[model samples]
Target: MIMVFGIGDYGLYEPHEGHFAMVGQEMIFQGNWITPHLNGSPYLNKPPLLYWLIAFSTKVFGAHEFAARLPIGLAGWLGILIAWKWTRQLWGVSASRIAALMLSVTVGWFLFTHQILIDVLLSTLLLASNYFLWRVIYQPQSWVYWWAAYISLGLCLLTKGLIGIVFPLLGFLVLGLVRQDRKLIRRLRLFRGSLLVLALILPWFIAVEQANPGFWHYFVVNEHLDRLLDRRFPPDYEVSQISAFGYLIITALWCFPGILFLPSVLKFTWQEWRQGFRDRASTLERQYSDGILLLAIAAILPVIFFLPFSSRLIYYGIPAIPPYVILFGGWYSRYQTSVSEEQSDQPLAISIKQSYLPANFREKKRNKVVTIYSAIAICLGICFVSTLFFHSLIVQSLPPVINNSDTKLLMFIVPITLGLGWIISGIGIVRQSRFALLPVFLALIVTYISVVQGFIAYQDVRSSKTLIRAADSCLNIDTLWIFEGSREIGTAGAISYYLNQGQNYNAKDIAEHHDTGWEKGNSGRIYRHVMVLSDGGKNRIPPNFPGSPPAYLIDRQQLQSYWNSDRPVVFITDFLRQFNDLDDPENRNLPQGVGKPSLIINNRKLYLNAAAQKFECNF
Candidate 1:
């Protein structure tokens, strides 16, 4: 419910959200559920599961932002539940509850919950698979858990790709090597499990490959391998690649507040490591050590896996968040228990503490606890002060980040609130208060809600919905609209979605067909596809954007032809600078007869061909 709160308050963001929202909407409009379509083109970048969920959601809830995001929100909700249940099973109820609370307020998890992307759903599915696999390891006699693990893994495969299986496999491999546990390996039944996974995922792969030849190579080698090696053709994520240090910083931020307890979590892991190596260890002791070790590995593996890759996104560490919270939950639960014991009147509690921990060790433990919270408080304090004093400096430095001081301040509110929360929580922790973490969690929830509300401030800058709506009055069934740009689909997706949906343009008409040449078994002719207008004569689809397919790229000759054609053509471009050139009477860059824009809003403009003047309407 928290994740879903006010989800529809803002318009869908450009590019990412607009892309997915429209693809799912197009699935319903086109009556094609197996293949995902954007604008008029098949979007082969991702699998259809996310689109399927979005289509089903919009079907029941109507075509709107809430419905588009509802699926991911619910997925996030389920992820929280999984964290709670898994933690309870491994640790206890208190830890389980804390884990859920931690995950709900996690910066990356919460932000992605409201997004229209596949990562939240994919991460949730991956978590489910991980939990069920862990269950298989602990309860080897339970075939149900085994089957559930495979099924979830298969769904993960459908959700993203090989990483669905790769992450879990990698984590378990590291766990097995660390423990030298061949028993877990033998219990896996790799042959049968592999067959089950193949059965579940193969049919879709086969069908998609048959539908589009070379899809296997494209998806497997090009998309996966080339992407890993940073050699993807028609490169899409050149701006996304980050250094190793950048990855650490991003991961730390994603796991904020939760990361405040990192030193203790590491300390606990180290203690467990030493315990596991001890000459004398009980079954329960080994079990606890192994569980902590597994959780630690699960939490860090994704970060490690993506560290070497040049292409990375801030949200790529989402799958790691669940285990991270679980680790925090276990450590925090122990800390809370110890505090309670210290305050209790029971002689048994006093004896246990004195025997297990000497006075110096107890003092050191208390100091460590104080140090963690104090460090976080100090850091947050510094951030709050820096942001308050250097507000103008920040706004000037990142001029393109937020359009105005208000939105920049709004963005700053999150960190400010987080800083204050840490300060209060630090006091509570120093006093050994039972609810020390509550204030920070509450602040996270409240500030995130505010962040959602404040997000609308960027609607004009990030979304083209309003601009597209202004042009709606001029549009009709016969109006031809082409987004003119050479860059990746920016607001073009939002424009395409709004234009097609507002005017009741049929899916076929919106996705006006051009020869893709793939159908004639002419592999050579396949180069003449969607995006790029060939340098001289050929056509090529830039791999960067599969979001808005109905949008056609316009070259000089095509622009001149459209301008001179008797039929109505609405030339739309979001690049305001281009509109300036088009408006200049002396600017020969545009066709000779081009005049002022018929409609202009924000950074987008619409020019009416001579034939479109008859259909002109004001905003």
Candidate 2:
């Protein structure tokens, strides 16, 4: 419920969400599911799993935000359930519940639920693959689970390309080498498994390749290899990647308060290590140790894979989160019902075998539990006080675009809610109460939901939905929508999506043309390639796609020509730089023919040509 709550309350987020949603919407518009299209051009960057799901959802739920986001939400919910079931098998019910909640409220998981990104879905499929692989390791005779593992892996490939196969294979390789266990690899039936994977994924690849030639080169070399080396064309996302230290910071934030319990887990690990060397471990002990090792490797391997690459995004480590939370759940549950004496003397596997807490476990484990609870409480308290005092500085330090009252309010509320919850849980822990950690879990859920609400409040600036709708109202079949500025893909996509409802375009008519020299005609100079599909080599009066007439990124010459022309033209400017122009009189580059904007909303200015005044418009 929390994952899907109010997903449709705000418009799709600019760029990423808007980009995917537009592609999915276009799939339905074009009646083409095999090849994803954007602005009437083939978008070969990502696989069709997310687009296919969104297109399916849009069909069932209508073309809206709810439909676009529902698929990711369901994926996230399934991820939580998978974590719960896997943890229950490794640990017990209490641990499984804890693991599920931890995975649910983590910053990355929670944020991605509301936003339409493939990372959450990709991580979930990978986690499912790992879970099935775990089952195969324990029950090698169960060939059904083995096939299931390969099937999940194939789905992962469809979700994000090769990483689906690469990530899991890497984890399995590291696991086999660490444990020197060849039996698991032998039992994997490599020949059969490879065929199974290929069978699942090859049909779509072949079909898409046949539909669009040169897809194999672009999808594999440019998208994957060049992307890994930071040399992909378009060079759009390089700025979003972070440093090694930033990757660590992102992972920590994604894991959040659970990461703070690392010291306790480390102490337990040290104790287990000493116990393993001192005595001949039982079979159960060995299995428990193997499970722990597997989880650890699975959690860290994705980071290790992407760490050396410069093209790693903050969410690149999302696949690492599931195993980390499960590991935390396993150890925390052990401590919760641990024996009275020092944990160092006892094998950690004993706790894993136990199904319920002993009657006399409470008073003995109180001190350790209280210590963990109090330490977290103190940390939350410090964060709360710091936020109260330093919030102004924090907001001032943020980029001017997102430094709004909504973000400020979020800063104040999140820490306070967390600090208060931990304080209450701390008191309960001291009292030897059952379910002391419940408050902390509830608090996290509340904090993330609050975070989403805050983003919705600031959506006017972050999204161009309102502005697009305003422009759509004034636009008609004859009015041409022209997007100005280089990085307005989100606004362009939104205009194409919301305005072009029930409209159709012939894909064969679209042509990609780039302007090389200065303009000698009314066909304005395009900054790059004009994305709009033209009519019979006529770039001046382009054909409409779905909502309105063709929209293109036009240079100053084209702006002047369109402004002076008799045809109705609606110009959408980039938010930040265009707004900056309004502030600086000398730098303002408005053409003499085009006067003041007809509408200005959320820093996005909409300029209308003389012929557009026929329709009454307000901003």
Candidate 3:
């Protein structure tokens, strides 16, 4: 509930989430459950499962950010719990707890689960589907679990189109190859499961195809195959080509702190290899190792499978973490139990023969714990010092950063608290004091939450929510023709969203708007109530803003000219409130003839070409 309630103040628009919200709002407002649209034009970007969730959420919650993200957040919790249950069954209760916590705190899962992205939802379904499939394979006897696997596969298809099914199929194929079991294929109940999956998934595809003639071609050929093969696609898709290693870097980053356990992994694997695999292990121990191998396959293969592709995103790494967290949790649990015993008499080296790595490299010796805690303390001290003076650092940054005065001493509380907390925790951990460790853990959580808050504040500055709300008083939104280019989509979407009051108007609803962007049109004060353009002298003004030719180049002079006219026109552009006065080094290169804006919105400026009446209607 906390994940999806009262988010009016959290104002920021990411690339995909903006479109998702627009479609959801359109669905609620237009009552069109099929054929989603963006800016009044057909939105062919993705399937509608996520949109359905967002639409329903907005319907109940009144179209707030919380509504936009609640469904995915709920889905994330479901994924975590499923992973926890599976890990517990495979390992133990402690491993399950660690698995849940690890999944929640991993950089990728932590961030993506909170945002309105289909990837996280898809990842959850993927994990669930794979988990059930594993159950059917290893712990099987029940049709119920098989049905669950089939249902998860079908829903996965709904969540992310083809890759949903493709991922599971690939994973199953890998598992069969790893086990050298040719009979695994026949044992999977391919016919029944495939039929069940089709039964669940085909209706939407058939309906959408019938309603829109080319739905299949666009969604499959263009969205999936083209991007998969080319990595880059047409400009309409707005994707850039990425190197094969791009996603690798992202994967490592997403699994942060977890990846930091590599040395531990190497250390433990070496120790295990030195001890050699004994034939005396019990069934439960054998199952644990088997589970780890399967998880290792599931976690690592998706990353490698993506290597041939050109397109990449951090969220694509989401699928890789479930197995990763499970394996990690298993290792941590084992280490906690084993570390109390004698040290291994083996040299530390990466074992090339052992395919698996350990979560904890070495036992948590006293010296090692001290070193780790001491390093953390030093890092926190630096962060604390930086926080004390971070505002001055921000003042010299880009205009998008919020500038804090040297005197808002209250800002120091969070950093100081964190720094001191880290120091205390480090000392406690080094001394192995349980009481000190408790507050230290709490402090770590506080530090994490504080980082989230800091991220929000940093991103909030770049948000044009303030500018859009302020400009709300000066424009006739019902008839406004805001000009926005590719780079300006964030601001454009925000302005359009505010103007419509969280209602999504289709891209083709131009009778009430025009965002034709700066393509080659001329302007000579012909616009009626108000106009908002974003380039703001950054680019040569298009001769025609919403149309072609007959447009004057909009610069400081042209904006000021319109602002001074008796028949006033309001022009909105992002600007620094005190551009020349800012401590920013970029101010040294300010345009020679830049003039003042008529209205200042926080730090972003607005130049108004005012008419006798400005903002005749309230937003």
Candidate 4:
């Protein structure tokens, strides 16, 4: 699945992916490592840590979609490996595999890993940090473990900024408050560890500040504080606390069935945790129980920390995933024990088995029977409806896919058939054994991945790169114009990366991010290639722009410049044109829009040119 499709091949996936690609390409093009400049302006929306990783990858691989996303994909895999190893220590060898599988199937981990985003890397680092911190609490006399926690904390800071460190810090404080792990604090080596973290990140921060004055205020005050406090100038996000239901919904979508096992996780964690405080438990049992308690607290802290924030995206809930999966894996391990005829592996699982074992059929047997059959029924029901009514769903509820790329009947039919086969197999297994639930569940997830990959491939490259492909034809005409038109689905960033493969690619003309409008092209020089959107989805125009600027009026000066060009000046405008022109007419792609000038020149753009500067930017 990893090798099957290109990141840019599936469309830049709109603003988030496009932004990452653009920054990476720019980092390579400019050879400026300290300050990540985009479109000749300091693009400080995010810290340069992720950009540096991408820059290194692009430097080695030459800015391909695969190269841009390779690091995060690797990070995701590393996260799974770490989860597997750590779970083995907390649970057992079998639980380790289950924990790793849980993460692999998580929608958030899978998607974010493949896509070029900071969160995958951030999530991995946080997982490691919290894992080591727990080691610091339970496994004493380990200086290396404390260092690992602090080192990961620093890297996390570089990846997303203050929130990176803030998450672990809050989780630590929460653990200390709840578990009273005070000795762990003394062992943290605070002074040495603080210096180590600062040493790793201080050079980059200093370099950026020296290069761009007032970066501290914009980065710390605006990007960090204002964004979090919902007080940033120009207000990027609305201010309000999220309801508990919102948290539940976000976690449900992210963790899915595993999250549904929360009650079981809480029950097991609570029981083990209570035993740790009792004097009768052995040293090893107390150590294992303490680890579980720490994980539970770590999982809950992020949700509580973000509760007061007025603005939050569902992805921000990523920090909770590692702990939740660990706990879920424990429940699964315990469930396997009660059902299996073999001896349990962990002491806790042994205890659970002792309580669970009964003369006749156990409650777990009844629960397993009900749950597995109910799941099978739901799967069959959804598959039946999808296979039978796919056409109707497309006509009404669903958005149309390009090139008649509709979901095939076989796609639905084969999965449903396999599911029924599993159900039948599961029923047979339940008579003598209940371990079939594990294989059946694995088959379901593998089937899901296969189906998703098939749909992605069927969707094809043209569906995603419409505007970029449209622009591809104009390169022969020598009508060079910096992209001033927005390409939704973030084809713009993909465009910048691909189009800039030429040795003479303009740093100014290709708005690496959103257009700073400081490019020399504003002086009006006619050249080759189509230019569209350095990042201007917010600068939406009519389907027929320049001719009719109903939503966003083009500057008469820029319009005249393009019209008077010696050769045909090709530019695709009217973002709404995609509605009629593209094959996927109904797909309303999401684009990044905040902190940008509208098609009509706003006050900031005016001020930049207010100093008798000639405004010659060709849209």
Candidate 5:
């Protein structure tokens, strides 16, 4: 219930969910599934895979917010399952359980799970591919595992482009090289695997390209290459960059309680190296080496791949979390190893036995410390979950008029949750739970939090119906046109999606499509009846514009000339307060000879052209 109930609503009000809904609606309306076109031309900002998934989902569930976000929630849930299975395969059931619990409660996973984005889907598929890849490496005879890996990789490609494949492929290759797993490499079937990957991905690429001319260049080259190399795209288009070392620190902080075991993990690993890799040695030693290596690789590889490019974002590190959690689980598993009493003649054997055994009283005390740390981690997880639930409840209870207060209050929840988690962790240092109680308690907390957060998200989505309705009213206008002056594509996309119901309208920018006869023979007759939606400020009209202004301008002089008389023109803007000072006649310095707006609407001010009243309404 938590996963699906509130999944659609949490952040649906803003640019994210609204924009996605627009794209999904367009796909349905146009009846063109292959090429996702926005405002009429080919939209190459992202891969078509996510849109295709949402379209298919909307067809099944209906075009509602919950329906749109269903796939992402499902992917997040599935990621937990895959994390469990993969970790269990590496370190046994106990570790798998711990890893799964860790992932279930992590802040990043919790927040994004309810969002209508492609990152979770990409992460889930990547995990699946990694799981299968691990199986192939461990059991080379399993051709099915190899096939599964490639298939998952292909799906991941569809989800988020090349980085999906690049991160995992590089990690796997580098790890294999480090471990000198020659047999695994020697039995490689690259031909068959490549074929499977191609078969899965090529069909969509070929079909979409054939359907939308220039689709390949814009999506693959311009979006993927040009954006990365030149940063010529819009400011919001790229991810922020962090130094490789800073990434490690942020990742460690993000991982929190799980990261607390790093020292022990390292100590355990060193013991293993001294012992010579042997099965009979301490399990703790073996686990520490394995966990650290895997976690380090997972945590570091994605950052390395994205660091070179100027773009970086918090979610870019998402793929790293699962492996890091698995490492945490492995470290937790080592606590079960029993100390050996017998002294060994062999130096390797002695090191292994000593590291594995809690031989001395001091070592036994150390074991207690480790147990307390695990307890702390569990407490932190619970606190994080509780805070999110509280914030959701508060937000849901408040009225729309209190939106600013609600937003401010909502921001406090995460930090408080983190602070509380730290306090609980501190408490765990002094108290040791009875054997088995901590794990069970932690499990309950994780499950409760996941379900609760999911529910809140559902309610959020339901509340967003009003915003959608508002956008819908604008769509009802027969002569609707969007101005590029102050309107953002993000907002425009959301409005367009809701209004157009996902149909491809070939909607054009007011300036760019001005000459296409939209305003030609119609003149003021066309302009009089048409309802223009604009940001109503300094119209920074692009140079070498293709079309005339759509009956609106930031300049009073342009308005007077266009209107043919100083009747008054209506100006629409969300930021009406910004124009307050400009409205003052004393402060208004006319540019050589220019006039100011004559009237203002709620956010929109009307400065009517006296001659405009004489023109016939075309509609």
Candidate 6:
């Protein structure tokens, strides 16, 4: 499946897409593991732990797509196992099983597990820390558990920076305060444990910073603090003006099926609390209560911290999902009543037995029917909401050329999946079987659909090897290859890596003058063969360059004359005169006078390049 998808061929999206892969490749090529580099300069965006893992994996697996993505999938699977183990210890076997099932099948988990991103790895660390902390809190006599907790927390820091440590600590503090577990709070060994975490996390920062000056300032100050507080980070600075309250509201809406059960879970917790914790409850009941409270705190704390931050993305809430699932599982598990209570022996044995006997069959049947109905309604509601959202996304993404029938066919898939889930849940409800099992089935279907969609989208919109192929084609050119226009790093990075084959490549902006030192005598010129890959829109060419009134106005006579010059220039643009001049018949003659046949590839005119000869002959 991984190979079939050509996952290795796909690069990361813009804004940090090439970062991990590029750095990891450099680590392998340079045989240096301490300081990360890109284009032979210090790269300090993230810690080198993930890069190191990727590099090591590439070394073993031969640097393919599966090797890069293998760690994330493994991390996700480990996270599920940890969640299950910890939940079983804290709550019980049933709740732990349900939690594991939910984590394994969630759409977010499924999507991230297959990608070469750090979110899933971060999630695994955070969840592991939470699990270990829970173990320590419950069994405070175990110093080993506390050490394990510190180790996991430190690794989390390595995975995604300070927030990984900060969020879990915040959740623990909140849980302690709410539970008033004074003994647990005082015996936490904060001083020693914190030092251990720091000890584990600090070396990388110190080493990387010493090796590369200003690494701390740029990564810690700019990327971490400034990005959150100022919102002036990469990609774009236009912040979402939504208030903190608005963020909370939107997050609740986005959480979907999980959020739908939040009210019910809270109601159950409140009822348990009002009953008085010390009044009358078994040891099992107390443990369940503690687990629910801890899980709730863990789930809500991260969301609270992220709500105030200026930037908000959905994936920021990934770590919270597991705890939320545990909370839901704990709440549902409590509703089960045992039917094996013994009757008392008395002088009137028959009368005593009758008094202690279970309820009538008809009454039991009624209770079962009611539980079934409630479960069915909840499943139906969730399925309906998910279907609506999926349909909305499909409708918005439909291309203009798609026919009505095609659009309808595409849109119907979501509702069909929804209907199928509803039917399965309804059957479970009627049979009085496990209701939670229905969600597991639904999640499996959702995961399958999401993976399929991701693959299809990758094929349709993503050009896997365009830059690499183009770079490979121009490898032998003696002229300095100048990448003109903006510093969109994805295009620039891919070109640099493939063309230079990990060597440094010189880049100059279109606005900047061509350096005369490199350009002396034709061979000395920095870029003798300029490869312009532009969309060919207006104002794309620099105003400083003296050209024949842009490519649009150049006639065949002018073009021939310009080509005859000693220093030939290639202008790449997507300016298709035929498409642009279609609306104006008077301007139709503009495309006809060139006498140049339009360069076509794969049945489409090359809108990406103006100098067809440079690329056309090579391809």
For lDDT, the strongest prediction is 2
Candidate 4 stretches with Cα past 4 Å from truth are 1-9, 233-247, 280-282, 338-364, 367-391, 395-398, 403-406, 409-434, 439-464, 482-491, 502-556, 574-619
**All candidates: CA RMSD in angstroms?**
6.2, 7.4, 8.7, 8.9, 9.2, 10.1
Per candidate, the number of residue pairs that clash is: 0, 3, 26, 12, 32, 7
Query: The CA-based lDDT of model 3 is what?
Result: 0.58
Quote each prediction's TM-score.
0.84, 0.83, 0.73, 0.76, 0.68, 0.70
Candidate 5: where is the Cα deviation over 4 Å? Answer: 10-13, 238-257, 260-295, 336-363, 366-429, 434-468, 471-488, 500-619
430, model 3: CA deviation in Å? 5.0
- What tens-digit string does per-residue lDDT give for candidate 3 at 292-399? 555666677778877876565546777887778776665555555433231231111111123343433233546563476457665765677576666556445534
Model 5: how far residue 260 lies from native, Å: 4.4
lDDT by residue for model 2 over 1-619, one digit each (tens)?
8889889888777667877888888777667788876665567788899999998998898878889899999999999998898777766676787788888877778888888889989989998888888677767799889988999999999999998888788777876786677886786777788999999989999998888777887789888998899986656564368998899899888887678777765555445433322356555555556566667777888788888888888889888888888878766776665453324334345443433332332646555546666677766766675677877888798666567787787888888888787877766666665576777888888887787777777777767777767776765545666665333244456656665544443322223322221111112211111233122111122221223332343456666676687766776665534233334332244556677788876567777777887676765
> What is the C-alpha RMSD, rounded to one decimal, of candidate 5?
9.2
lDDT of 6 by residue, 97-215 (tens): 76776666665666666566687788788878877776676577898989988999999888878777887787778767766777766666778888998899788888877776666
Q: What is each predicted model's overall lDDT from 0 to 1? A: 0.69, 0.70, 0.58, 0.57, 0.53, 0.53
Candidate 6 residues lying further than 4 Å off, grouped into runs, are 1-11, 179-182, 231-256, 270-276, 279-288, 336-397, 400-414, 439-443, 446-450, 459-464, 470-491, 494-612
lDDT of 1: 0.69
> Candidate 3: which stretches are off by over 4 Å?
1-8, 231-233, 236-247, 265-287, 338-401, 405-441, 455-461, 487-493, 502-619
Looking at model 4, residue 466 earns an lDDT score of 40
The candidate with the higher TM-score, 5 or 6, is 6
Prediction 2 global C-alpha lDDT = 0.70
Cα displacement (angstroms), candidate 2, residue 50, comes to: 0.6
lDDT for each residue of candidate 5 in 444-548, tens digit (9 for 90 to 100)? 344445444544534333233334343334322332232222222333444344444433233343334233212211112211112223323332221111123
Candidate 1, residue 594: Cα displacement in angstroms equals: 3.1
